[model samples]
Target: MGETSDDGRLGLFGAVSISVGGMIGGGVFAVLGVVATIAGAASWAAFTLASLVSLCVAYSYLKLNAMGDNRGGSVSQLEEYLDDASVAGMVGWTLLVGYVGAMAMYAYAFGSFSVALTPPSLVDAVPLGEGLLRPVFSVLAVVLFVVLNVLGARATGLSEEVLVVAKVAVLLAFGGLGLWYGVQQGSMEYGFEQIRSVTPVVMATAVSFVSFQGWQLLMYDQDSIRDVETTLPRAIYASILITILVDGLIAVVVTSLAAPDVIQQHPERALALAVEPVVGGIGFTVVAVAALFSTGSAINGTLFSAANFAKGMVGDGLLPDETGRASADGAPQRTVLLLGVVAAVFTAYGSLDAITSFGSLAFMSVFGAMCALAVSERDHESVHPLPPAVGAVGCAAFAVLLGVHLWNAERGTFWAVLLLAVAVHAVELLYFERESIVDGVEHAEDLLVPGSG
Candidate 1:
């Protein structure tokens, strides 16, 4: 059933939908309020900056993918070029964690928008307060998607195509109508006047980097894509460019529709609230519904990708082989459940900003490493080193800014993220040295048992 001929593979439209769907799925909806709070009227500029860096990284991916037919994403690329299984394993771990964080962000947005849409009386009647309900709903969403993934219900083929079209249409409509309304009311000019300083914009760019990461998912699905050489590049570039415009438009329109303080106060439901001025209660409902759909799709798509990624890692000997066991249909049920549980924990404990920051930082680190690899391997005539060099430097700089922003604004989250990173690396190290570790454990058991050996 997994076998497919070239005629059955995805074309340019499908490939573009995958990339666009990945990027626009939940990022813009979840991070709008955070960006508005940080960059004020300059939020669009921050998105633009982040898109530029994403473009650079996309270039690196394009070049690297051209060099080989293997499709393990960054791990495969690193293993092939650097020839270091350890580094590849470490990056794969980080990328997997980053995907989990992304799913957490999606679940958070889904829960937030869902809760925002409920009637007040209904919400009030619940035993749990609104604060607790959000996470409860978030965890439930994760469970639902995990179940779906295990059942082999994916957001690909025609399903993904429809979702991409509907999502882009809804977002474009909101942005366009909001912008028109703002201009009609002179709010657009006023909003422009309220733009923040450069530092905040830079910080916002770093915070918003995760939104631009969906395109990277395409790298993992290379086999399903037709004409991988030509179509892949076109689809990746087109999707990112489209996402950039969509993101910028939404940021401008949202900031113009509401004040920064107003958005900050309701970061999770910022889009719903921001659009309320343009179309009354209907706008709120529309945005909330859109968010639910977007976030739901994002969760399903990412969960599936992450599960497959875990399975691939196991195949590569990066993860415990037991985790690679799959269902009859070849679904990595164990890893799917594992990723879902971790994502639920993240959603339950982490704030939107914290999750976004961690996810963005994790991806930035991976992208930077990839870009550095591209630069290091520039001896090939087809690879130009300049763009990747810029990408590496840009990602490094933004990662630092993200750290500073988090340390100053959310010190607790900063420490939590740092601890998580350290833990991921430690796990990677131990996994690589598992044989020695096993031997040491056996020796300890022999000593303790006094002749068991």
Candidate 2:
């Protein structure tokens, strides 16, 4: 077993904040409306089901972290256990693309909320080109964060702390007020009545899975945490449990406040409408502003984590070395820039459903891979076969959900995401092979020379 040497940086609270911040980002506010269309008022139930699946996946991650040298998270675990550079590279690549899709989703949410708040006169006042408002602002949000990250790590961390606290506070207040109103109207029964068949709820789980993406962020902090063994599992459980409760309550509150049809039509602005009856226009404004902050914080946190992940891949020699270069501020400038540009392009063009599917599937696949790894290595001393086995089954259940979604929907973008993933692995195998061989030859030479030079 290994121990953690704390540099007095992140305590239990800090760790929780990182995970919560990453998970809560634009997900609830942005995707809730879409989920409403799927799961009806049972959207909260969908959130609960998705949380269960994510919890199962988290079990595999905790086990993997305990057994291995405390270094990287999922990607590291894959590299160690799978022992295949091409496989690890594919996982890493999918993760990179997933983060990009997520950032684009957040950016899209930011633009949608920002545009909703804009005055009609002001929108018309801008005599600029057509279809430029949301896309322009979305790209601008990406650019702003890229610059913020390039400023340095300290600034980024501090911003996340502030944003996390603020957004959570706003959500708590909103949830409390909405809960009070629901009680007054006895809306719980109505919410229950909205529940339909199992298939829509399952599909909703697949889409809403994006909201829980932040739990993996905790894995990235294994090295910095104070107590590696105890603190890691406790922090992850606490954050996820708390998120599930909070998210469930909020989902119930929103559904109680507004009809499913209303939320579906205004998915982007549903939160504002949910609290409008209780708090009036001020409530709408509050929820809207909170969403803006929520989406922005999500973008910021993802950029920070995604850049670090890319840099780690560079360290592992999975990616081209140049993309990992640091700038004056010690940020992975190249990777950050690349991610920003890609997110910008996606934000500018991709629809919300497309972005959500891409991000959700990418993460769902990663969780599935982790579970499979656990099952494969269950014979290890620290590993158990059951939870990983169960987790693998849970992941497969969600994959079925994805498949159903594709079959019912248009299927064009689904095919694209699948093709893109296949292409990434194929290219990684061909292009990355030469570098792996050179690395192997160099290692062998060093072993043979033994400082002879």
Say which candidate scores most in lDDT. Answer: 1
**Prediction-by-prediction clash tally:** 0, 0
State in Å the error of residue 138, model 2.
1.1
Segments of candidate 1 deviating more than 4 angstroms: 1-6, 69-71, 189-196, 326-328, 434-453
Which candidate tops TM-score? 1
Give the per-residue lDDT of model 1 (tens digit) for 186-275: 888323443444788889899999988888888888877777789889988999899989988888887777876788877878777888
- Which pairs of residues clash in candidate 1, taking residues 3 or more apart in a chain or in different chains? none
Residues 1-453 of candidate 2: C-alpha lDDT, one tens digit per residue: 012224555667777877887777655777787777777778888888888878878888988878787456778888788778778887888888888988998998888778767776777777662257878888989999898887763434456667777888888889888998889977753335545567777888888887788878777766677776787788788888878877877777887788777886667677788899889988988888888888887787788888988887887778888787632234588888999999999889887777787788888887888899988888898887887887788767776777678667848767766676677667766666877777888888889998743
Report how far residue 443 has shifted in candidate 2, in Å: 28
After TM-score superposition, the amount by which residue 227's alpha carbon in candidate 2 deviates from its true location, in angstroms, is: 1.7
Off by over 4 Å in 2: 1-7, 126-131, 153-159, 189-196, 326-329, 433-453
Error of 2 at 205 (Å): 0.3
